[model samples]
Target: MSGLTVRHPHPSDHAALQGALTDWWGGMGGEAGAQQRRLLVPRLFLQHFAGTSLLVEEPEPAGTRGGAALRAFLIGFLSQTDPDTAYIHFVGVHPEAQRGGLGSALYQRFFDLVREHGRSRVRSITSPVNRNSIAYHTRMGFRIEAGDRTEDGVEVHTDYDGPGLDRVSFVREL
Candidate 1:
């Protein structure tokens, strides 16, 4: 983490990010993980929202041709429908980097960046089954928005992603 730097993602990063996504998600090696990874971070985000996204990478030695390790990343953007709101579309932290504050740092940086752009609130969502995500978001000061349905005692937006894909929506007021 010492030499890691945050910068805007490039189109070329899509492959590396995709290659390591499953591992970052704790080796999601089954069909479910495969399906999720396919839709996770597309090249369009890097191409269109590079300015709004952040990529944390550990640069290779001066002489190396490539091989920078992707430590973490956050894809966020100011809301077009809601002038004062911003949305964190996606985020991923290398498994080894979890609990080391990398995720929080990414979120904090996004918050600061959005605030500078006149955003007063930030929103995000996670699957109901991801208890760690639910806990992490709350610990990061995001409050779960009450939904019309509840799953496993936690309120969730039913079919937020699609049929049977419930999501826990969160929002934080800055």
Candidate 2:
């Protein structure tokens, strides 16, 4: 989108990024709102996975943005538990920048980096209620894992996150 450039996220970017997600409650239920999720995200993710995570920006005065700015970001990493797979921890695009391909670009960038590192697959999980995330992951070539079932219109993986917080897990071959 708009010739965006990509790079690792700096520590200072966390607050702004978190703030940007303040209203991004789509798909997530009230129990897992943006604000609630923010508390669970440690700052270390930005510091430790800087190389694998990425920040996407639009050049100054480009597109609808008035100046060079962060358009989207991806917080992902090679899985520590599974060496052959990478995990996309988080990904967000400013509402204004969405639908402009910025999110796709960030995903493509992650796929390339992980593939270079010998990763043969990628995985991610989202709340069952977050339909937007499920669709987006599917669009990125991730498929729902087995055992997931639709309940009351929500495709769920029972107890995926905890006893009650069912989640949708996605997997994609790299």
Candidate 3:
């Protein structure tokens, strides 16, 4: 149990983040669905870090402990929807690190970052069947904003697509 540091992501972290996502989603199902999940990362990374994505890291004991491991991440960007809105493109806590309060810490940092930019709202979406994600969001104080929605198979539906992947949208005012 070390302090968690939340900061903006660097381009070099992309591969590691992708690997984490693969592992995270694959644990939920298999490579096929994981492949679908991978598609979201690039888009969100580009959109958010076009100059803004947040990363969470926890230090491990120096010796063969693998140094710092990325524990959670939030990829999103400041939006013009209200100038005061931060649209969360995607958020994930490494499977091994779930329930450790890292997710909440990551989001709190995100909200603080948003507020620094003068944002007043934060928005996100989660799969309808992902009860864990829904529970996490609810616990973080998000409220359902839209009913469930699905994307026609041909489109690449991501979080920013407003609950498009058989999910529902949730929002919280900052």
Candidate 4:
């Protein structure tokens, strides 16, 4: 990530990030594409958590006209739960940039940003079947938890998102 900068997401950057998400996941398959597009709700994070979320960009290429390619992003915040853990909401690594350790870099940058906030944990959740995410999170040091649990007074019933869509919660000590 040298020569690239990681910083708070600018409000106007939402549309572009949304586009990147659509493009990145749309490359997987029709079903995956539709599901991925449905996953973006960027305003909530950009509006209130610009400092806790992150975006990293690099020069497009030697001859490109644009400023740089938006390679990756993470939407997260300090949890409202009693312990005030940091909760990561969403993350995306552009298809072209996947497998290059960009995801880990994004997390490390966020950790550096919030390390002084007195939070001891960073948490996230993913669909139980998204083994890739589970593996990635595990590699990044998050403990994977399987099972249904209530959260914020809502029954995190099985398939909390929909039929056959149980979630796998993950927590990493900060």
Model 3 segments beyond 4 Å from truth? Answer: 43-51, 60-67, 148-164
How far residue 39's Cα lies from its native spot in candidate 2, in Å, is 2.3
Off by over 4 Å in 4: 29-32, 35-39, 148-157, 162-164
lDDT of 1 by residue, 1-174 (tens): 577999999999998778666666765547678658757788998898888899999877788887788889898888889999999988888887889999899999999999999999999999888899899999999999999888788899988888987899999999
In model 1, where do residues sit more than 4 Å from their true spots? 61-66
Residues 1-174, model 3: lDDT tens digits: 358777778777888788887887646658877776777787447444645578888887678667678888888788865797888888888878888877787788788888999888998877666777777888899887744344432112255444544556778998
User: Which candidate comes out best when scored by lDDT?
Assistant: 1
RMSD of each: 1.7, 3.3, 5.0, 4.7
Q: Candidate 2: how large is its RMSD?
A: 3.3
Candidate 3 residue-wise lDDT at 116: 93
TM-score of candidate 3 against the unseen true structure: 0.80
Judge candidate 3 at residue 135 and give its lDDT.
74
A best-first ranking of the candidates according to their TM-score comes to 1, 2, 4, 3
Query: Arrange candidates by lDDT, highest first: which order?
Result: 1, 2, 4, 3
Q: Candidate 4 lDDT, tens digit per residue, 125-158?
A: 8765466887899899987654567543322348
Residue 85 alpha-carbon offset, candidate 1, angstroms: 0.7
Worst 10 residues of 2 by lDDT: 23-32
lDDT of each: 0.87, 0.81, 0.74, 0.77
- Clashing residue pairs in candidate 3 are 49-52
20-80, model 2: which lDDT tens digit per residue?
Answer: 5665545454545766778655688888999999988777764565755767888998888
Root-mean-square deviation of candidate 3: 5.0
| Ten contiguous residues minimizing lDDT sum, candidate 4 | 148-157
